[model samples]
Target: MRGVVYFIIVMLVASSLGCISEKIEKPDKKRIHGPKTKKIEEKRQVDSTRKRLGVVSGKWEQLNGMDGGDMHFIYSTRSGVLFVSHGFGGVWRSKNGGESWEIIKQEDFTDVYFYDMEEIGEVLYAGSNKGLWYSLDEGESWTKLKTGFPEIDDGTYHLVSLAKYKDELFFTAVLDKKYRNGRPGDGRLFVLKRDKTILELEAPANKEITVSAKYPYLFISSPYSGLFFSTDGKRWRKILDKKTTNVFVDGKYNLYVGTIGDWWYIGRKIGNTWKWEQVKIPGRKNTNSIFYFLVPDPINENRLWFGCGGVSRFYSFSARGFGNSFFGVGCWNGELKDWKIHSNYATSIAFYGDEKVKTSCGEATKYALVTVGRQAVQKTMDGGLNWSNSYEGVFGDTINAINPIKSGILSGTIVVTAVSGTEIAFNNGEEWMKGIDLRLGKEVGGGKLPGYPWCAVSPERRIEGKYDLLISTGYPSPFRGDGVFGIDTSCLVRGGRNCVKKLIGGPHYEMVISEGKLYAGNMDNGIDVLDLETMEVSKIDFGSGVPLIRKFDGKLFFETYEGKYLGDGWRWSGKKGKIYFYDGRVTKTIYEEYAINFSVNNREFIALTPESLVYKPDFLSEEEIRVKLPNKKYTDMAIAWEKGIIFLSTDGEGVFYTTIDELKSGGVRLKEFNNGLLTLKIRNLVYEDGYLFAGTRGYSVWRVKPSQV
Candidate 1:
């Protein structure tokens, strides 16, 4: 009896092994029988460079505890490596899903951005604001593709699309007419054949372009220029008149187009013509919604997953959007009646796995990962019903403001507020974590003034090993009425429910703490003085609205701005460009007129005007001393008073520094001081603890000892 059972088990095992081998030899021949389906399988075989592994799943945690600002593209390989290109933050890679990430490469050219990426086997290609780049060996290193095109490295080509049609790879770039050598043109499209030769083709316009392949036919969607298609690579024909954002083709050869501000919204190709399919999104109208990207389900061809956002013109004064949020992700199962949407802005989507999983609501998807703009990467398992932020090991963030404590138990701790909210670094920015919990409740405004921590200031005193901070918020809607909140460091460790508390509500832009008073600047209101002893708030009208206020040389100096109000329903006239000096009792105007930014050293005070840099010996002096700078727009300035040097951060020309005495003498030559910086487009600068910290646009934050410069 035992021998008979063993024989039966052996026979069953052999039968299963034979079936597996047979299935591999003769794969499923299921085909999407639609128009122009000839040679579709051959094309699929040619496009075998990308192989997907199992779904990426886990709790949403900071990928390497950093924010990679505005992710433009995301790709994954069968070897389990993930890649993401932050438009300004540079390119990042991860081996273990998103548990951690390391920057593999950044644009050598200043202000250029990597906008799109494509994976072909072990090689990867990227399109950028300037030109094309390629990486071999799984993105550990990269090199620019400068062959064939002579001017590819000129920074004029805004390469927007890198796609594959049939077996040929192609890229499209928008060239600015101002840099096109008097040529009346929009953009260029280049194709890389199997033999590596390049062919130039005419593109519709230089605007946002998306290219997709549907067997033998190729489709191109250009915003504002409509949609075009071609059977051959050289010639194209316009088919649609509406502005389109993206193009997608499913397994059944069905064509779908994402439109921008179109009445027909989403376009679907049916039979031989295009049909408008309106998938009603909740709380959104056709005019305000934008279907950004579309991808077909691998197992369920009828189901389509899409990424969407709102049009730029859609502004909400209500509590929900407060201002505007063009962000959403969802799926449509060929049903116009219902769809699922998760509110977030997604740039690209990739799928993995073949296991069918359904949500409690009966919605299903295999496995998917999406790269959301600014919010970084996210993943979903049970379709679009649920999603998690998979941004571990990613660090493409724009540091808006940075504040460091000088002494006490939290002495070495630094707090940085950025596009991804607030982060606290206990070890001087070596590692960071989510800092404060802004109890933004639920819904649009979250019942509180929904905004981000703009700038934070702490009292010179600490209690119970806890530091208290008066953190100011930014982008406050007029409907909410305030942007100031307070937090204690104790709540940061305990994860308390009310980690942040509202102090004073109103439009405050900048804040400074001195003595027992907190001076806050605003756009609509003048300056707000909040007394810590009495907790009473009072206003100090500085004629126009004060946008900048700082404590320099033991006195307060602020700049007033003349600009129109841009909040929901708020209105303000304007004020002249003026800088004022404020003591605890009195205020006086020092230097007025078109000042961009100002700083002070131990010798004198310097202010950057639209035309030149001006210096004055006394705070109340009328004598004008000027230092003519190069034709570069200075965005921010910082002064290391102890070092007697002033640093100016420009929009594109990196950073320049000079001695304060040289500027006063009117013969100062600004010297470049960007030795260890990643990006030259520094947005903000801070000097603290003998280190000059630069908050850049796409490269997170950098700090260097001032003495080294």
Candidate 2:
């Protein structure tokens, strides 16, 4: 069955048993089965096919893992200079095969956010939100390309893709006429010849255009426009009229185009004629799958790798249930009767080399390095048979919460709960170590993993004179029940999963330890008090749960949520929220507003709403003041009381800082303080030792000195 085309139809059930033929007949239209029976039968077929193909499994490890953040594009030049671009994190270069990475910071390209990057000869070209950029010294520095595009800063043209045919470099620039208005625009192709001359041509489609080239053949795949081909780099002709998402030209010149529809068509040029086959992954029927990424095998030209997700080429936002039937990295060699499904939800990939290395599983070879969508950068040394997470020296996941150990032997240490698991930083904010086992990757049915650690609190008390940590786990929609778990800080430094104990069961948005008691503010249930000595539990209910909790000057204050749930960490739905002062006896609603989270100091209480921050001074005084902020949704806030500084994190924008004295004098100037950060989607913030730790949505934890800002 190698190198054969098989048109799979409904009656191709026998193929699941590792048998295949040239063609399959259609099923009888009159035949029908019950929903339950049909589902079971389909599962059986999929299981059989996957088992026959020896479903590749391994523990994934991160490579070039320097808190690289969420990757937008990853490409490696022929000379082995790997470039990975993070939209706001800037572009990073790894010369030693991802062993270490450094951000490419240049004077002229500080704010340039690259969407695509390609190398022609020794010059690297990048397409950004502003304009096109080129680097001559392997990304040591960069210079903007002077293409005479209209209003480069005003978003007139956004270069999205780049390709090369012979000696000429071709690029696709989307003419974004709306600019700051945030709307889609048309795209066109431009040719950059060796003589520094530019030639413009009409693109096949207006938006969502992609270009790929391999020597004599250059192809463009545009969603809703069709696949186009060109040999001389100027004139083009349509090859397939399908809603294509991407085009991949293998080393052998075999063309593959992925579509958004039911069938994926593989286009192969035989002689002067082109042949197309509607192919499917053996056994499974992917009626809605988006093959937005494709890469040829570095060692084998026949094998084609792919990445699947629900994102559409036409739209920027992810559409649910569109192409989510399969989400991961997979490969198809055309010669095989089945596809080789690899890692999970990888949007981009880059090969290191074709060298075969010795592995634990017999004599296998190392493969590629892939960015696993805000999780980690993974590498497969033994062809995906076994894997391990390579997060050493890399901070690539989202940091959900940060806890600074103020007491005990691990004092001054910063412990954080990220998207992957728990990490502890003992040396101020310089390095991090994953020593605690949080059981992060435990599956919770429906093909979903449990929620990550949302909050952590380190108490002064110790067990066996060793440091301990109490972490609460939860997300917007957690697959498992949220609860607080305690773990010994000394275990699992060298990869062990023991020394963990569940202390309490419930979703806790905020937690604080006062004296010998731990007060946790739950979103579903009301406040729960746990005595550190006896581990006894007590509940305080005032008709609703609290979204925010604090311990100030021997007093417990919490915010009650009489609003809708916003599907986040104890998020206060914009309806109503009241901060109450709890004195261990009675509760008083001191301040009421539409606040979600807040930070407090000795003088005033700074509350964060959906739109801006609310300042209440004079010990919960009736004066409710609204501070001005940029028109961005704020998520979390923190305060350095001694320094009189306040920090705010946004959902889209980066971190903003202001002084508390400025708020009192009605001159609060909230300024953005993101200098070395890579991501703008800040999730939470905390302050300690003049360093402000920002937990971003994708880039993990980035710390900045307030004095520098």
Candidate 3:
């Protein structure tokens, strides 16, 4: 069995955790107060090392989860390790078929992505947008293999596909509108020979290349022309006039051609001259759309999985998507199981209230906005009933966060969103405006690579009676130091294009304003607190520079380090990681454990440990209902008071939500509130007007009402 399967293991860890013990007040070990009004100087140097000359660009990528984006490539090794690549820079390997998987590696460089992987003899090879990678130790580790590969002029290269043809190996290169030697870079296919370094095939360039599993046929789905076939590698044949989007050859050597409407195929060795028949997708007979990849499932010997509707401009939204999805994928197993799509890889989702929009019976309607990968921006005016990208000028390409905000009293609640890079744009409930660089003019080539850029408005302590736009260049290093920029909100409203952006360059857990003080915790070196009136910066001697300062129950709290158990690669820095409450001068250690991520809702303290989302109403109660979702790790969360639900954004697997009333009931059913989300891996989530907006890795963004789910 070597395919993606759903396995939910219900854990009753919540059963016994309610009786867990609690320790309090290690006074001397707690708070690290500031040296009164003493200021600290900058010491860390700005190091922009690797990608100085390269144009840094990244699509919607998630630094948190593993399972997302488009499933680009999947290769099963003889050793039983199945390597799969998706959107973002997600690459994972499963040893026990596709039932159990582990994160081999994630993104490390600029625009980290893998497209194809193959098991060549003993060594496994992978083709990525950046370059080629090979694993010698059964995918335990991977190393870049760039022996003779040419570096493109843009510094980045896209190796689309790779396959073995009998004894000779062939690879396909994807060009990105850049020209070289009077030829488009995307238009090249080459074969590796024993003596010769490389040999270009007779096949057309710039088109997608694919090979048959056992047959000696090579097919190219051309971006310029239609389909081109090369039987002997040296000679080629064109299937002209037949507009094909993609091609695939099954293990039975069945040639399947994908067109804009429906699919056509021809069976094995039926002679060079055969009839291509339009076939129904096993169970989905009426699905009038094209598919990308066709692969025989290893688990169900005769079954197949279709990488449906990918992110391509060829995927015409005007003609309708694969039912509200551009990057929608599906699989057909057996007669009983039938045809099904378990997930939708949504990147980021948001909502904008339209008081003007109402139902026929007359009820106010709120527009739901979602970025479905290359499908661009999709909106559902009447909730999730009908989603369409009909509206023009929305720059939804790889957006990270989509926020609906009231820019001004007259502007109303429109869209002010951030893409994967450093740019942030606003849409005044009509069309998208030109995005502004949050970097302003600072150098982002070095440690400052393109990350998930986020924007926020100062909630309180208005500087000079005016609010400032606080923007952070996504999570460059998880919960560590991220780029924070403060600009006067008035400047943006007044169209002050070249306004001065105050760049507080350093690492911090989080920066915020409370009681007229700007607290920048986890400075990497030390914690810094700035006075709003004086603009004086004083170093707070927090025990750990990695301080996650959060406000809960009218008091300020922070984390020192990680505790007991770990979910993933996060360092469990022993007993150092504990919850501490700050009382002006000193701190008090409250709950001790690995409290990396925590939140407060309705007077309850919620701590996210490796094991569970521990909740405590008060510090006095020794009882803590440590409930956890089915996921190993999760992303951000939102507490919907009206819905009385605690929504958790997962690393993968969309949102896991449960009602606060149910948590008190002890035996709770933590339901998955994902309806239209194709990708399980979620990066960010927000709940508004009974709608939950989710930001995914590859599927882009999607929204579904919790009550509807």
Candidate 4:
């Protein structure tokens, strides 16, 4: 029965196959096709793609590194060679002024100590923890001259000053004598001669001579004995014998002494009689004060400079003119002049001023606005000509978004989705209104969104008929997302009391308002176009690919993973995907979409990811193409258009600026700040008035003004 069934099934299948074959023998007349042109068209497309790739050739110039450390002193020799000694280990030498530098010598023992350097003939002498080391051949080799000095049991020695008096070398060494409890200092002073003979001075017990100087006669100051004078280097005489901390000898042989009790005295030698007069140091009575060093003007002997507050204060003096005092890390013209504050907490000060005027800037200005990481905002007015703190109120610290409404009006806002709240401030950052509950549950379809908000606006949006502001937010989550908030003068004029309306798009998106139409590049969704008047939304798909859109030359440019295209209002169904061409020819393969920013002049556009800048001449006759950038990765850039300057904020370093001519001339000139650097993860660059504002991650907002830079 099984064999009969199998035979019957096989016979039925053969009959069906024969019937289908008979039908296949006669094709339908309507199904007939034409001659092939696909091969010819395919060859043309390949050649076109290759031509596009050949146009853009070179890469961008990489940014130079900005090393960090407190440079305590910078000195230049008579030959115009510059040297900088860090408060830490290294000593840097600059052959060509300070345009470039190289480390010459550094040792572990010299770390974290102030070095007193003096040049005698061609030899350079340095005093550090390891006693006195002399380099006779300009730092080529070193010899330790610690013999004949008091033994430093704990291997600690501090040399405060070195000077040459009457053709004899004099140096002051503080030896740390061991005690039963292992504490330093039984208070000993030593005088070293030019011939390396060390004579120990008999310092009073329980007192230490903090500093010593020579003007042929050795003068040392003690906390217990006012002043001690040694004319022959061994036997010391207690002259004034009042407790003094610092002593200096003037050109007229007048001795100036500063005491620990906040008083100064001057003693003049007249034949056989010495007269002592007490002087007052104004505005320094109640402060922790100590006079450290003094410098007389090279061109003027009557002019004297004093360093006080242990290396912080500076005072200038003259024979009859008003003295100038600098209370902080700044300079002074004369000792009687009023104190001027240059910076809030200046780490270092340098002079590039002329004789008639002395100008000093601080290192703190570097991280002014853009130093804050996430939730940082910076704003300035007067086209970056001047700037003020605008993030004080909003974040109660610094913020990431600094949206400026006008010259005197600014807002600092921060969005943290995890906290379920956002912060907003108006009135130029004097105060902030925070905890604006984003009713996400009632306002939109929400469970728990993955990212925070990033805000941006179109160039056409106006604020107060003067400046323009676009507020944006970005997701702090793993997935990069953005949200944009639109504000007008009416909202800002009301001090942000009015609820500013939100434009369309979600966490990871960008909203660009062009020609009165709002265009959004969505991460999950395709590009969405919304009519400003009717509030109608239209979505254009790049066929399973995400599209990033930018508006240029009065048209919308869309880029996606597949290709590039120019969208016509509603649909991207245009001419297959035309590549950017020069002389009416196709260019290279369109890479994956990322980010872009305009140069200061707006004549050039910089595209991110495999970072590159596209230059298009103002006239159409000139060729247009993309040029690759240096190897360092950059996420965003800000331009000071008037200055022809560009600032790139990096991840590991800080903000750097260069000129547009340098970028075009194949030279990359970058100026990196040592201070005021927030996290390297900068997201946005915006300039308003005279200041350049930057937004960073974790570090919130930072700003730098032209005057400050």
Candidate 5:
């Protein structure tokens, strides 16, 4: 057990004693888990058996980028800062004019969506679900405008348009669900006066007012009142009796009024008689209905760019949400791609495309392995550019785990776990041999054999000065690992009942090593540690459920599982699994949620969560740091500090990454590194040689190079 091998096989059955050797790594601090005075003393060194993978370096390949997320309001400031509201996510601003964008406020617009945003002078006015909000400091902060738009019966109000008239800012608070039934009265057209007082404009609510400096008259399109034109902002004239959807007046006094059912009425003045001609919209055929947009084209005079929204469909399990009405993004540029005709909403079109970050490709390692989820295990010698899976299509079930040991008696050997149990690859991945059945570790007839061939690892150990593989049952498997079955490369099973006793009553999946002893913590059983040299199983309990345990520097730190459930709130489970810390029988309540799959490196305790990567320097007195992820459901993350990069494995959206230092200090950017990922559900991630590896749930394992920074 006094070894730097990555093998963590925890078996706690009584056995004869052997000589005990130690590779003691000293600690500066230890957490006293005793009652009353429970506390973690100081920091300590990291002497982990398995070293971390990946490097801190280089440029990455190409990705479509910014392809996901729902689109909301799009605005361009006077300084040419283009911003798009990415649905549930906050505002994404493009500094160099939409060449790229970074999320400025990722948590904004969670409760509501933005309706409209326009820059007036220096302040940026935005109409949202909660009335009009003006941002004086560019988009950093926002304050609600008290322009007669008080909160209705519902908490939020629907603000549709914000316009400036006669040196005053006017906002039209339109019909919401509370007011749509004509109960909360009419929509309010309020204006912000010069003295900062909000005064109600003498105009009908629920009507969109179209203003143009080139035209003498202002047109208002109302659902009930049709089209009304005002000459002096007070005098009104009924221009058209037809229900107007959108009224647009260009610079040359040409009016293009759109109605329901894809009708566009173009009106222009010739001397005195104004001829209004109706025409069908072109280039938008085979698309869904059009919603909010009309940008006058500077390049093409006769045509206008429109936002032809997504297709509408009924909700059902078979539909899979692809038939949404707000999905399609349309353009009248005389060209259409196959994807444009599909049910995808494309907003905020920009040709200024540039990569947000550049990475430099570094040298690759000679040996690399690839394990697909239900497929073959391939290996490459020329740095992953080429792979060979000679024994493919042999296993009917999916391959789960791949553990390659380099310098042991089973050197150049790999251990694989799948639905049918463990398999071994003798020469890197050329040939694989089926090993023991997966049910060997489980109780004889307990609840049928678990299908998923979960944890499998072969730790390198020297028994009686003879180097042999003495590890099994990787830490915290799909379930309780049942027991450890030590086997050699040639299907030679080493440990039996004498090897590991039958574990019952509780799950024994999560395993760790400390003080020359292998410790296992399960959901039910309190705790059990195995002294490898003497080879004896000893159970330790604190009277409660030990859900999580980590062994560091001869001390045991554990948390009692309480009310952690899978389906709580909008989360599967949080990394905050520990409420109390324990060492031996000593216990102390830290009152912090630091980790679920916790790992400590250089005193940095990394807490991997579905939402964010929580980081702290130590158990106590360390400044807490959190790196927010763009998407939820983060499966795995790998930090390559030497090359200065950290890779994040997103569930369906592929991988994203950022620098190590930037992540620790609330990042400014985290680029998606999905160059070759086919599947969305990425389960595992690792960094080897110069490639960032992603183990997807479907398709196959993907590898990409992290360009050198």
Candidate 6:
């Protein structure tokens, strides 16, 4: 009867093994697919090289637009140059007649705008949101000219126009106190003589003014207070006060005033008597109005240029055609011929809308994959599709490994075995707080640690939570020693005010927590597991392999370079390539080779290799293997057993993932997202909630959600 029962159990076990093996089938060979590729090899090289330097390269191409800002043009007469300032301090200068442009400078200043420029003899004057800037050597160098300005509102003053009349210069300064919420004072116009002295002029109370200097007289226009003429720095006379906004003067002293309302007047010098006459142009009458105009021709006096609304016109003071229109800037030899618009102007008009085009994702939400060459970390949020350069500022260009604290937050530790710097970010990949020198004591190596740092983060150590950081460092090899530091999440809530306690230190590689026990892997000192409650440490010898601890099914599992130990006395030996289970007195070995790592999911043992996952039910005899992963180059893997997910990072290819069931089914069912990488060369993977975080050698850190892919 006992033998009969044993035979029934054996039959059931055989049947179960057959069923599991039938379910696990080898996946069909298929071409691996990643992110969209264009210049794959070139991008890979650029991404890798930049990661080594610890400085992000290339312009933030994604921040072209999508904000409420306008682009204004700046021209240099001395250099015949034209540039564009994105009103916000980003300046791009074009040298080749608007053919191409290069960024000159991008300063971070709020509510700043560049207004006008004027070259007087050898000095170049620029009017902007701040005030006036004077360059002595023809725009080569500039100095702030804010001597005689009002100190109460100097930086806030907006200079609208700068006009040079002979040796003297006159400028219109608008004090936008309204924008400042009725702070104090009104707008004024200050005339600066060639001697750098202010020539005070009597102006209206609080009107926005525009000015133009024409030798013996200066023309000023207000949006609502009409036109005024000033001479000798003090006296002013009303010329055509009718809500005018812009004004221009020719070499012959003929004044042209444009009104915000529907009016463009031409004041001619007839026998010393300035007679104002209204000239009619061809454009629709009473619908469009002139904004401003400029006469670039130095020779022709009667040749008038009119800039109305969004169009430009040229009139000879004689031809009677509907508003004579001509674009571009050049001279005519007084042939009384119809003027033609320049081709460049036509092209500009054709692509005018392109100027406002911006990336749909603003500066905050975009993701970038970054990598450092060595001793640093890299990250890419777009799945190795497009990558940014390495982020330095943290480890002073010496980052060893990265651990994700939480979503959009990462921590990097240096290699030299000392706490040097840390970086934190909250707004996706837009900006980061760099150079957070925690100043956590001296170097590990007596030979000067290259910003020696190695960092680990708890599950809640992101922007949403506080504290939760661990770091350790020590000299490499023969001089190795134990030094570990830990930071509690609650203490970080108040901005790192709490002290960091020392744990154990050595050439630490990885730190993990399993079953409420903290474990630190060291190269020279084996593995140290600390009891969070008792504060006691236990050293585990991994023999020739490094000791690693991981949690599965609420139980801790130990791994070494050779094989794995599943708590109790069960040990899987890779020497004979077999599995064994012992009840302390006897040991058994079963034939099963090429298994790399194992985890327990739902009380079942799951094994992993470079390209597959194996599931063993109860004993090795009843086992099933599935080939899910591709043969692509990979560097590391992290499994979240409870979530049934596996994160695989590649060398220069970025990070990817798959499910446990998909892997056991032997059919590679993986979804690769756009992470912007050719080779991520990741070093580690961490999972918290449903987000997967990747750590790379030189790359900072990266994170993404399962559903986001």
Clashes of each: 13, 18, 32, 70, 34, 61
lDDT of 6 at 90: 34
Supply candidate 4's per-residue lDDT for 201: 56
- Report how far residue 336 has shifted in candidate 6, in Å: 12
Residues 579-681 of candidate 3 have per-residue lDDT tens digits of 7667667765656776536655444566655545666665423456665445346666666665456777666455666666555543335556554343566
Off by over 4 Å in 3: 1-467, 473-483, 490-497, 523-526, 561-576, 628-631, 688-690, 699-701
User: How high is each candidate's TM-score?
Assistant: 0.78, 0.78, 0.44, 0.36, 0.41, 0.37
Ranking by lDDT, best first?
2, 1, 3, 5, 6, 4
Q: Model 5: residues >4 Å from true position, as ranges?
A: 1-24, 30-416, 424-453, 457-481, 492-505, 533-535, 542-576, 579-591, 594-596, 688-691, 700-705
Reference-based lDDT, each prediction:
0.57, 0.58, 0.46, 0.39, 0.43, 0.42
Worst 10 residues of 5 by lDDT: 1-10
- Give the Å error, residue 559, model 6: 45
lDDT of 1 by residue, 10-121 (tens): 0111100000010011211231111221221101111224332112111111123335456767777666677777666466778766656677644363455566677666
Looking at candidate 3, the ten consecutive residues that score lowest on lDDT are 1-10
lDDT tens digits by residue: candidate 4, 606-650: 333335544333212133344455555564565555556666665
- Scored against the true structure, residue 218 in model 3 reaches a CA lDDT of 73
lDDT of 1 at 243: 66
Worst 10 residues of 1 by lDDT: 1-10
The segments of candidate 6 whose C-alpha lies over 4 angstroms from its true place after superposition are 1-70, 83-89, 106-112, 148-155, 177-186, 204-206, 288-290, 294-303, 310-709
User: Tell me, what's the RMSD of every candidate?
Assistant: 20.5, 18.5, 20.9, 24.2, 18.7, 27.8
Model 6, position 108, has a per-residue lDDT of 25
